[model samples]
Target: MRRLMSNNLILSLFSLKMFEIFGCIWRYIAFVSNQNTFLLLTILKNDFITKNFNYKISIKT
Candidate 1:
């Protein structure tokens, strides 16, 4: 019947919207994790460089 078809249409639309929202959330999480990893790597690299520089200076003195 007409009422049944309309109900089905509304249900499908609602499901589609929910799916889109979840997809966006997933992508955001992935992006944030990647950014955090990059930051951690940068900090570790700088620390290593600084330590090496200090060690060399100490050796020279």
Candidate 2:
């Protein structure tokens, strides 16, 4: 009975540790995804502004 209880306690602790690791990994992934999205948006905005500038010049010419 003592051995069984000890095994159960160890298993519970292991599971808890694994959950913590998974949570950390998930947070990291979310952060990277957000950063990537921000970068993509900045690039798109720059492209749009550049295009508008070109169009205005062409019209003036």
lDDT on C-alpha atoms for all candidate structures: 0.63, 0.63
- Please provide TM-scores, in order, for all candidate models, with all chains considered together: 0.51, 0.51
lDDT of model 1 at residue 33? 81
lDDT (Cα, tens digit) per residue for candidate 2, span 2-42: 88668666765775676566556656665778877656655
- Pairs clashing in candidate 2? none
What total of clashing residue pairs does each candidate reach? 0, 0
Q: Which lDDT tens digits does candidate 1 get at residues 1-61?
A: 7886686667657756755665566566657788776566556655755765675466446
Report model 1's TM-score to 2 decimal places.
0.51
Lowest lDDT 10-mer window, candidate 1?
52-61
Evaluate model 1: give its lDDT.
Answer: 0.63
